[model samples]
Target: MTTEIATLGGGCFWCLEAVYQELQGVQQVESGYAGGHVANPSYEEVCSGGTGHAEVVRVTFDPAIVSYREILEIFFTIHDPTTLNRQGNDCGTQYRSVIFYHSPEQEETARQVIAEMANVWDAPIVTELAPLPAYYKAEDYHQNYFRQNPLQGYCAFVVAPKVAKFRKIFADKAKSA
Candidate 1:
């Protein structure tokens, strides 16, 4: 199977990781850091907002099963792109909405998707679009955080809702349990 990668940061990486993990064509979803100046930043360093890194997820998917545009559509639905440097109570530059495109085609698709989504939101879309940069995988404990810590406070209260929203809104695209 052909695999394409999409790196995205929309609030907490846990939330985006949880939702993308359930999408049908997504082969792998890795919580990570990107769009930053630092090298191999730790989660705490990123959270401090000094490393310039945003909490991001590197998603590997099969384009034949799910197009890049469809992946972007789900992304827009699951997160508030209008809120700059934050999603809900999560704050800091690390929580900003961003899309790190891997190719020219992916960049074009992101631009088009953002433009279309702008009409849907009353506020302007603030999601950043940039070419993919150096990505550092988050700590081992962070991978599949929601699946591993479903009852954890943040996972339960925050990540779960995003996962549920994706399931409810895009049932057709969700992987079978």
Candidate 2:
């Protein structure tokens, strides 16, 4: 019956945005920047690392339909948590794996998820489980990037494949949305 927001950064916002948007119980997904010191950073500023922002997706979801744990599971599966400050070809602190929790319970669940992943996976999870911060929404063009620009080069080459894989794996979750 309750709604919750989970802000995460694991890689390109386009990729994360595409994956989470199709999820069941997810009300909305906004691509943004967080865990940064600079205020109201522009996309260019964050890319330069001067803003210290990580590319993130702020997701609003119904907890009754999808638990926070399930969201975290999807997050961990969508990207490589072991690659510190990078995801695939994109390399930067801006692409770092992070979970910005709004409450103590979210923090605990994030930590537990990381721990469980570390045991099963060879590499230690480098994902940062941190307190939520002020998130600066990305530019308008960046919103719904994959859906709006499905045929665009980046969406086609970078985001679409990840999204396809996610949808294939999490088909049931998305179908119910």
Candidate 3:
């Protein structure tokens, strides 16, 4: 399998991690921080909005199974691309919508996808599509957050609904395991 990487930040990393983990082509999803000025910023620093980091997830997937466009499609569906620096009640710069493209092809696909999705929402898509600068894996506690803390209030209320939507809307693309 030819593995490709896609780094995305749309709301919390936990929500993105939960949704991508169930995708058929997805091999691994690492919750992290990206599209920021700081290097190796901690979650608290990101949350403070001083670090300028967005909570991101670096997904490893097989393009043969799911194209980069498909990944962007899922991303657009799962989060509010129209909202700037926030998702639902979670308000912060770290919760902003962004796509850190790994290649020229990915960059082109992301732009095309955003243009196509323009009619989907009344507001213009605010998702930042940029070349990936760097990715720092979040602290160990942040990895697999939803799976590890399923009973947590935020995971149950926010992340779970997103995951459910992913499974229901992309049923054909959902992983068997």
Tens-digit per-residue lDDT, 38-146, candidate 1: 9999988999999999999999999999999999999999999999999999999999999999999999999999999999999999999999889999999999999
Q: Provide the clashing-pair count of each candidate structure.
A: 0, 0, 0
Better of 1 and 3 by lDDT: 1
For candidate 3, list the clashing residue pairs, or say none: none
* Shift of residue 116 alpha carbon in model 1, Å: 0.3
> Compared with the true structure, what per-residue lDDT tens digits does model 2 show for residues 20-116?
8999898999999999999999999999987789999999999999889999988888899999999989999999999999999999998888888
Q: Which pairs of residues collide in model 1?
A: none
TM-score of 1: 0.99
Instruction: Please list the residue runs of candidate 1 whose C-alpha ends up more than 4 Å from where it truly belongs after superposition.
Output: none
> Ten residues in a row with the worst lDDT in model 2?
168-177
lDDT of 3 by residue, 1-177 (tens): 689999999999999999999999899999999878989898899899998889999999999999889998999999999999989998998999999998898889998999999989899899998899878899999999999999899999999999999999999999996
All predictions: root-mean-square deviation over Cα?
Answer: 0.5, 1.3, 0.8
TM-score of 2: 0.96
Estimate the overall C-alpha local distance difference test score of candidate 1: 0.95
* Top candidate, metric lDDT: 1
- For lDDT, candidate 1 versus 2, the one ahead is 1
Predictions in order: lDDT: 0.95, 0.90, 0.93
Ranking of models by TM-score? 1, 3, 2
